[model samples]
Target: MHVIAERLIDDGVLEREFTLGEIPGVLWTPPSASASAPAPVILLGHPGGLNGMYPRLAGRARQCAANGFAAATIELPGSGDRPRSVDAEQARADLRRAVAAGEPVDGEIVDRLVLPLVEKAVPEWRTTLDALLSLPEIGGPVGYSGGVIAIGVRLALVEPRIAAAGLFAGSFVPRATFDEARQVTIPLHVLLQWDDEGNDRQMALDLFDAFGSEEKTLHANMGGHTGVPRFAGDDAARFFVRHLR
Candidate 1:
């Protein structure tokens, strides 16, 4: 965890940009965080491309800080400044072409696009967790929140350090994600955008139903992708506060 830069964002939230080998990431810690009194951390997830996602990620991070928690997010495999995967790029192109033509996306394209990403990204997230937890100012039990829903599913199922997850259900969920979802036992809070053009609403609901968690809640709103309302974010923050505090 090599911190490349640090600045105070606002309300005394300290934002740090860092790199782990080739992967770049950002971490935000609240003023209350310290060795004597560490803050619980939330790992923020996104579809991909950290640079494009920074503003929203930072807003969520500050919200986490406001709620007395630290937040961090790393660029996904083949995203932002990382080396791109040719296979992933092709699969993404296929998806976009299908969407542009108003044709139903083939399941094979989703499998090709998301499955490998899940396989590679989950381990990186676990490694990030390892590094973050080692910091005196950031401690567990950790919470995960955001999209690339498949990544969140895999982490909740396999990563023991994650106590709960608040997943955004606005992406393409591979079939393997449903299989994994059925085995996840951690608490979950899923947000669904009913009118997201790129997402299959039924699939999101089915995936939520497949979750094995004894405690789970779904928040469905009438909006497009990126139209998640502020109140919804407030609700998610409360969800994390209940579990992580």
Candidate 2:
């Protein structure tokens, strides 16, 4: 991990833009934080890509800092410094066909378009965590939030370091996602935009229902994907506090 730049954002949050190998990203540390007393950290994921970092994920990072935690986000694969793999379009076509046909996508299709990325992404996140927690400004009791829903599902199933998670469930879910969700027993707070134009409503509900976390919550709001009320962010912040603090 290497630091690219560090600066203060609105209300005095310290935003440290950095890279893990080739991954371009930023880390936000709360104001008045102690290097000696490391603060808890959150891994903030995004729906679109790294371009979603500023103002959205960036704002979330600042919020985490204000609520007394450090937060960081890495650019997902096929986003930012990473370009889409050769099979990306084929995978999309395969998925569209499967969804249209109302059948499970073939395992090879999953391996090509979706699972490979998930496989690559999960490790990068773990590696990033390896480097992130080592920084004196970041401490334990880590949490994960935001999504490319698949990544959130996979990490929740796998990464034990994340003490809690707040997942945005407004994206397509693979058939295997529920299987993964069923293994995630950590405290989870999922945000759902009820009428998202681009999402399959039943899939979101089903994925939430499949989660093994007895503490999981589905925070459904009556809105399109982007219609989430501002206060919902506060509610999620409180959820993190309840679990992490």
Query: RMSD in Å for candidate 1, one decimal?
Result: 0.6
Q: Tens digit of lDDT per residue, candidate 1, span 127-163?
A: 9999999999988989999999999999999999999
Q: How does each model score on lDDT?
A: 0.95, 0.84
Q: Mind giving the per-residue lDDT tens digits that candidate 2 earns over 1-245?
A: 89989888888888888888889888988875678878899999885467755788887888898888989888877765587776776787887888788785565675566676787888999999999988877888989998778888898878888899999987677778878889999999999998986577887888889999989888988889878888999999999999888
Residue 183 Cα positional deviation in candidate 2, in Å, after optimal superposition: 1.3
lDDT of 2 at 50: 73
RMSD of model 2 against the true structure: 2.6
Best by TM-score, which number? Answer: 1
Could you say which candidate leads in lDDT? 1
- Candidate 2, lDDT over the whole model: 0.84
